[model samples]
Target: MLLNLAIKNFAIVSFVEIDWQQGMTTITGETGAGKSIAIDALSLCLGSRALANTVRPGCAKAELTATFDSSNISKATKWLAKHDLQQDDECIIRRIISIEGRSKAYINGSPVPLAQLKELGQLLINIHGQHDHQLLMKSQEQRRLLDEYADHQELLSSLKFYQSKWRKLNNELTLLQQNSQQRQAQLQLLQYQVKELDQFALQDNEFTQLETDYKRNSNAQQLLLLSQQCIEQLSESNNITEQSSALTQLQKSSEQLSQLAELDSAAAAIASLVNEARIQLEEASKDLNDYQQSIDIDPQKFALIEERYSFAIQLARKHKVAPEELVSFHSNIKKQLNAIANDDSRLDVINDELEQCFSQYLEIANSLHKSRTTAAQQLEQQITNSMRQLNMPDAVFKLAITEKQLNEPANHGIDEIEFLVSMNPGQPVEALAKVASGGELSRISLAIQVILAERIVTPTLIFDEVDVGISGPTAAKVGQQLHKLGHSTQVICVTHLPQVASKGHQQLFVAKLTDGKHTQTKVTELNQPGREREIARLLAGDEVTDSSLANARELLAS
Candidate 1:
């Protein structure tokens, strides 16, 4: 339920604070006295669109704040908790509109998007404007009202979920069908590429090993000549040269030092060093001879290695990669080929899944259709009964449920609902917009609201002059229904009828005050005498007479 409303610098309302209560509160004023200004301010707090003109002429901005007690409203409390904006059981919604046509919204002191404010606002209050009945003309709004009256949120949610899933799967199937030829062409190209790489037969680390073998074999004769020359120089040789071989010279030097060692210790050390050098030369010569024997000069093996190395280079350049990268590149192409081969199977699987999703969607849609059909019948009867109580004895209300073609699925299911009415005894029932007059529309709108009020969970309901085209006993019936609604929830009504104003448990009078240069609107909560005078004024216009006061008292007493 709404606890309070604070508005400042909004339109001609410089400042107004209203402490609302848990029953019907009527607002009354003279014509052009800004009686609806408070409702307008409350609308801003409910996230309605704001304009720069909403700000007072001399003020920089307009501010509105509304406080609600949501301790018993689970939907509102859950929404606050879900958004992490909960402040115990009190929900404060504030809106600020700047003169530049910009606006900001806050919930529980945390800044939020305007959409969040609107979403949370719906759970807290339902406002029925004087012209809300005009919305009954639209088919979509008709469907929504019927669905809301049906109270089958679970079924609606299921239908929407399956519809979403079906749409996604259907889109995938469409794309796959459109791209079938392109996928086939891609698959062929991948197949040929994979075949070429497979024939190359490159192995990991084989490229480097092949290069080493080729280099060693290509220089076989040169290696043999160099090895033989080194061996001949290190040992004794028959070559006719003036220089003795290194091994022969070292042996001769060792013999001369050994003879001198008997007379000198230093000569003995030198002889020992010469002998070690001779031994090292002999070992080096033996190893060189062994290497020379191991060298092969086979042309067949050399030609094979050269051919393999050239082919590796050519294949690497063809693939736009180094020879060492060929193995990894071959592996990647194989994987792509395998994936392309699987697309046809994937298409079949998607088609099967799409069918399953559509089946599920149809199941839920059929259930929802049945529920709506039943609800339409029940609501038609209830609203028809309510119309009689609102003084429309001959008015007939009907809900037309037309089923669309099954192939054309909609988020709201297959039923197209519309409200039809007959206002006279001999008149055929026709669309509400085409048949009902403005006064009839007001009563119809009120009847629907009063009937739906029992099922709607919103804590507060505000009627903005909904009794505009109603009067007499019909106006009293409207007032009585509103008062009855207030028994279950909070109701604030802006009205111009004495019958309605006299029924309010509390009353507020909106008065315009001016000093010739400036005008402002003030809302004052009325006590017993004040209410009597206001209701008397509503009954008798600007002049309050004894007869009007007596009528006002009798109306209040009743």
Candidate 2:
């Protein structure tokens, strides 16, 4: 339910804030007193397209803010989560329009695209406007309305699944049939590619190991020379490397150590280290020889390696991939080979699946059709009954459903449905939104929303001037229905009738005045006597009489 609305710098209105009612709220003013300016503010929050002209003259921007009471926001919360939008217990939707015609929408402090705002707004509130009447003239919209009343979403899902399967099968069959008389060369190439890939027998992560081995073997000679050179320098017999280095130096020092035994006992340990260094040099030399001998540098082996590398490179180039992608390339070729070789069998399998899907779809669709027909009939009967309550005693509503060739998902089936109405007996029923008067259409729209609100989980409904043309007892019935609708879903109706206004659990009055140079709009709640006076004003004209006050008081007290 809309809790409050605030507008600033809108056309003919400088600023206005309205605390709305949960049930049958009414906005009453003399016809041109800017009732529409208030509606325009709500429209902005509803994501209606804005124009620079709507901005007040000399104002840089126009702004609108709406707060919704959200004690039960499960549906809205789930949708917010789905769209990655912020979720809160309250709905604070705001819109800003610049004088240059740019607009922005925000929800719970998060910026949102106008389209998202519009989509989410529909779930929160539905505005019945002149264009909504045009929806009746369109056969497609009529079908959708009936389907919505039927609540047949699951059946539609099954039907769509079947249609998808049929299309897939048809596409496969057509492709194979078109290529059947030829394609032998393509098939042979695929098979050959698959066979070659199998011969290589590629394994995951093996490429890294092969590259490492290749690099090690390619530098084996250099590495062996370096290692052997180190060993030779360590083992040189005549230079410092022999006499001053390692073993030769140690031998000279050990002979001197015995002459100076008291001061040179530590020389033995140094000599031992030199001996170990000589052993290390010997082992290093042997290891180097082993490594050098192990490297396979035969011309035949080199040629084989070169041939394998060239093949890998050429294949990689053909596929526009690196040699390391060989595994993926092999898998792709294998898949293509399977598709080609098993084309006939796969086609048969798909055809069987298509037939099965079609049979299942038809069976369930027929059941769904029967259920929808029953539901539509019941819905039509209920709306027809509601018309009598709204003071149209001889009215009837009809649900018209026809078989249609479908290409996509529908809430129901491949059947087009329409809502037709006749205000009098023995008259042809026309589309509801078309033939009904402004007031009658409002009632019809209200009835449908109220009835469906019991089924659909939408949390809020807004009726914009649905009480425009109705008065007397019929207006009272309409207000009662709205009251009932509000019990289940949050409802806010902009009404002008005292019967309707009096039914509100709350009431707000929209008043406009020009303070010399600028026009301003202000909205405020009416206390008991004040509400009665407002309703009296609606009951009578510009003048409020005692009799009108009595009538207003009676309506409110009742």
Candidate 3:
């Protein structure tokens, strides 16, 4: 429900604030007295398109703010949470239109895009203009109305779910059918490639181990000669026998120096360093001997390692990957081959799934169609009875529901719904768009809205002069319908009829104010006496006669 509306620098408004309440509220004024201007301000705050000229003269911008009580508006609260906007039970929508034709919109103090503002606005309020009756003439709108009345949201959701599955299956089938020949050729190529790769018997880390073996095999002769040289230098040789070896010489020198250390302490320190060097030399000689013994100097192994390493390099170049990555590459190729070889089986499975999806979609759509048919019949009957009460005694309203041959599955099901009306007896019923007069359309629109009031999700409904071209008992009937609708939700109606105005729980009067230099629009909430005088003016035109006041009082009392 809308809590308050604030307008500033907006088209003769200057500044005005309205605290709205739940139930029916009416705004009335003479023609061109800015009643519609106030409605326009409310519309702008609710994300309507704006113009630069909407800014009052000498003002930089036109600003509007509408506050809504969102304690029960779960859809809007969820939307705010989803968009990460400010979250509160009080939702505020503000719009600013500048003199340069630029517009900015905000929701709950968070700046929002105009599109988002419009989307959120839809959940908060619905405004029906005097021209909105023409919307009833469209087939799509009529279908929507019937669907809303039928309350078939769950069935509609199931239809969408099945339709999506059907589309996915069909897409897969189309791709396979359109490229069957190409896929067959690809299958043969993949099989041959897999066969070639299978011969290599590639293993994880095989390339790395092979490279290591190749390096060892290629340097075997050089390795052996170096090991032999180190052995001769560290141990015995022809020129350096047991005593002449470096290890032997260091140990003998250290023993002699230690004996002299008893006479000098500095000599003892030099002897300890010589002993450590001799120990290291002995360990190196043992390791060199072990390495020489471990060397494998086989010509056949060298040849085999060289051949395997070259094969790996050539294959790596061919596959456009490093030799180390060949294992993963081989696995990927095998997967492709497997998929191609199993294409016929996969295609059969998809065909079965597609058939199943279509069957399910048909089932759900047929059920939805039945519900809509039932709803259309009841809706047509109700509207016909309502139109009669609105002064169309001979009016006949019908909803035509026909099954159309769908080229492809549609989410909305198979029924094509249209509204047909006849204003007089013995006249052929024609489409509402072609046959219904403006007055008849307004009544029909009012009837539909009143019938669907409880079904609509919008918290506030604004009727901007929907009572146009209606008066007397018929106008009273419209007022009574609006009053009935207000009992369930908030409603604001702009009107000139006294019968309609008198039905409001609260009344506001818009009038032009002049200070000789400029004219501005002012809105005043009328007390009981003020309401009586205003309604008397509405009944008596330019003069408030005694008889009009009496009638206004009686109308208010009733």
Ranking by TM-score: 3, 1, 2
Query: How close is every model to the real structure, measured as TM-score?
Result: 0.79, 0.70, 0.84
Model 2 agreement with the true structure over 1-558: per-residue lDDT tens digits: 677888888887777777765555655666667766766778787799996577889899998998876557666667777877655677788899999999889988789899878877877776665245445657776666766877777877777777776777778778987887565678888877788778877677656666665666567678777756665554444454333444445456556654565577766676666556656756765776676567665666655655666677677787688889888888887887777778857766876776676677677778777877899888889888887888889989998877766543344456767788999889999876667887787667667766777777666566667665677888899888877777776666677777877887777777877768776777777789999899898888879999999998999888
Select the stronger candidate by lDDT from 1 and 2: 1
C-alpha-based local distance difference test score of model 2: 0.74
Residue 463's C-alpha lDDT in candidate 2? 68
Top-scoring candidate (TM-score): 3
Tens-digit lDDT string for candidate 3 (1-558): 999999999988889999998999999998989887868888788778887579999999988998988889888888888898756689989999999889999988988999998888888888889888888878888888899999989999999998888888788888888878998898888777778778977789999999999988789899999999888767766763344766667778888988888788889888888888888888989988998998998899889888888998888899899999988899998998777767767787997887778888888989999999898888899999888877889999999899987656787889998899999899988899899888889999988887787666668889999988888998888888888788889999999999999999989999999899887899989999999999999999989999999999988887
lDDT of each: 0.88, 0.74, 0.87
- lDDT for model 1 comes to 0.88
User: Candidate 1, which segments miss by more than 4 Å at Cα?
Assistant: 30-33, 100-103, 201-339, 516-518
Model with the higher TM-score, candidate 2 or 3: 3
Q: Write the per-residue lDDT of candidate 1 for residues 428-538, one digit (tens) a residue.
A: 999999998888888888888887888876799999999988899999988998999889999999999999988888899999999999999989999988888888888
Q: In model 2, which regions exceed 4 Å deviation?
A: 6-15, 36-69, 72-126, 156-186, 196-276, 288-332, 335-346, 404-411, 428-443, 446-460, 468-491, 496-506, 527-558
Worst 10 residues of 1 by lDDT: 401-410
